[model samples]
Target: MTLYGLVSSFYNQKAAVHAALRDNIDTRTALEELRVLVSQSNAYIAGRKNAKLAPNRMLLQSIALYLTDLLKTFGAIEGAEPIGFPVGTNGQNVDLESTVMPYLKVLSDFREGVRKIAREQKVTEVLSLCDMVRDETLPELGVRLEDHEGLPTVVKLVDRETLLKEKEEKKKMAKLAKMKIPPSEIFRSETDKYSTFDETGFPTHDADGKEISKGQTKKLRKLYEAQEKLYKEYLDSMQNGS
Candidate 1:
């Protein structure tokens, strides 16, 4: 039966117990009614053995709530001993604690069983979903997961924004490195003019065999140093963010 049906059946049983108590039934009869209620609860649980996990969870929670109401009802009967037994003929004090203890234990155990199952199911689902994402989704997108202490697995992106920034900084550094050793400004021969390849794959040269002029070289060196400093700053920023 569905959770709702089970809950409805339990509710009807509870109503019968309530009516039995109100009618001043004999202690034995009242006890029997209570026993029937407990049995009904257990039967509901047994019947759900093959049910889906979600419905089972809902059923257990509903049972717990209903059991709370039943406990309150049991508490209200005057001069009734624990387990709903009446005071004895000899006027001996009823063992209220002992009588109630067994029923309370049963209810507590039922609630705890439900809690344990729910917690285990939740953890299993979370771990399974995480595994699927790590194993199936990440690799296809060139992403990786990094495990860390006291933290979730971090997704490592090949083309993340910070990495892209670092790439751009490296490109700037390369330009600066090339600038530090400036090319010759004047070419003396065809060999000098054909020394370096241009964007069009044609050879070009600044100066044939000579190095750059001192003044121009000094200016380029200053620019290269400044660029290098900026690149270092960028690198530090990236490291700090990571």
Candidate 2:
């Protein structure tokens, strides 16, 4: 195939990977998707004789997250996987290629790495490191790993609704995690635009940042106000241990 054709094919495979990871339907499928992604990348990298690539540049939070009993049971952890990414002491951000799973944290990290590589047009270096991680990982899978299916999953795959709810919960937790724990420091609410009309009653902008009819502006503003009130109630309920 021509170099253009080869590169295009490689990226299409990576897109498939992003889709699979974003949905995170099941662990089995995610692994299979990553394996397929890595294979195409291998071919593309082999053809890149013009660039010198460092296969070890990609970093994972832990080898055990892939090759050991962590994914098997994730012992000691109850609901979520670990939250941090791997980075070099030199302060360079590392890739999450070894985090090949359907869990939220792993899936999100892996997806972001793919996005960054595609964004920077630096696929040659990153994809090569992913294949190296795959090489190190597959040996530990042994007979459980299959050619057509993928690794045997150790945990139940939550349904789409549950998964989405969990994703939202993860996001909420991330936002809340930034704040100092309760009662440590006073929290100051950020200013928010309530409507197209600012406090001065001047025609301003809506959420879409466009000027609209007064009627439509009031409608959207009321809707958003109700949402904020309901969300505040939800947070209050959680604080009260409801």
Candidate 3:
């Protein structure tokens, strides 16, 4: 079976065991089912000689270790002693408390060992596989995975702040491209162009190089007044923090 299929089967078995425990029903059937699944997973791993199957092997091993611990816990709850053996032996009297304490300690130690192995091997491989699958199926979702030293690979959220900044910059550039120049600047530019010469392309002044026509002088004055008025308004807007 596929790796995903195996993983899914493992979870289903685990949930069955939990349900049985929660309902105070017969857990023996659920436990047996879990054991069978674990064995099948291990058998599949054992047949694979490829290095690519290393993660799958680790996953199965972790599941087997966890199932073993779970079985031990159930045994401890139902047995006369935690070890599932009679209290007093053939030759010597076994202290009930002492026997139970050692069983508890062994159970605890085994559980801790399983946790360490799962963290180092099974969990990391699972996370890496999840990231790979996500990348293949949902690349447009902007989700990402990152690896860390001495830690599992983690899912990274989309960078909304950077995306927002890029969007805003595009909008600002578009607005600036179509923006109208202020009236004050337009007026000044027009005035400079007209002052260069008369409409006929001749110098405004004659041989005397004094004043030109009064009409021309009046037009120039009106142009200067209009420019000054707009310039003052622009300065006022700036001062007001517009």
Candidate 4:
């Protein structure tokens, strides 16, 4: 299993033991499972280190050593006496659950620390990939790679012509944004070319979510007439570039 998967198994086993304690159930089975998972994680990291695996070997080893140190502090599992818990005020057994919770919390914090490191590693790798493409590949190919459908894992190449057209479209939108008109009005202007609106300038749609047409546009009430007026205005604006 991957280091991440190994770590998750250890954590899950620990949680199972905690839950067993909370429910006052027999914790023998859960404790056994926790020990087994921890042993497996240790073996996995040790084997990788011994063979000198190149990919993040130090990270795995460090995590394994850290876990070992924490478990040492843990003192022992259920089978051993005094499993890292202080006794009661009268020297009686204290709340085992409360006593043990702090150690588990430290383990949880360590897991989060590992997760933060993993995230940073991913971001660095992505930035390196971007730098490679931008500095080494873009000038050679004279084209840029864009992610397909907002998916970074899937990319499509964009030629100069397509890039220029996209830039021009962006410029047009920027100019439109600067115009002295409400955003709703600007959007309505674009829709007027393709849609039919009523006297209130609302789209000619009914409660059924379909366009409603009483009859031929000219023969109907102000609704159809308004649509015609909007269409004419749209055509004029397009021709005039207004």
Predicted structure with the largest TM-score when compared to the true one: 3
Is 1 or 4 the stronger prediction by lDDT? Answer: 1
Model 2 TM-score, 2 decimals: 0.23
Across 123-216, the per-residue lDDT of candidate 2 in tens digits comes to 6667565443333333333211111112221222223455455556866886565432332111112114323454433435644667667896
lDDT of 1 at 180: 42
Lowest-scoring 10 consecutive residues by lDDT in candidate 4?
Answer: 147-156
lDDT of 2 at 135: 30
lDDT of each: 0.52, 0.44, 0.54, 0.51
Between prediction 2 and prediction 4, the one with superior TM-score is 4
RMSD (CA, Å), each prediction: 26.8, 21.2, 28.5, 24.5
Candidates 2 and 3 compared by TM-score, better number: 3
Clashing pairs in 4: none
lDDT value for candidate 3? 0.54
What is model 4's C-alpha RMSD? 24.5
Winner on lDDT between 1 and 2 is 1
Ranking by TM-score: 3, 1, 4, 2
- Worst lDDT 10-window in candidate 3: 77-86
Q: Residue 5 lDDT in model 3?
A: 72
Query: After superposition, which runs of candidate 4 have C-alpha atoms over 4 Å from their true positions?
Result: 54-242
Which candidate achieves the best lDDT against the true structure? 3
Better of 1 and 3 by lDDT: 3
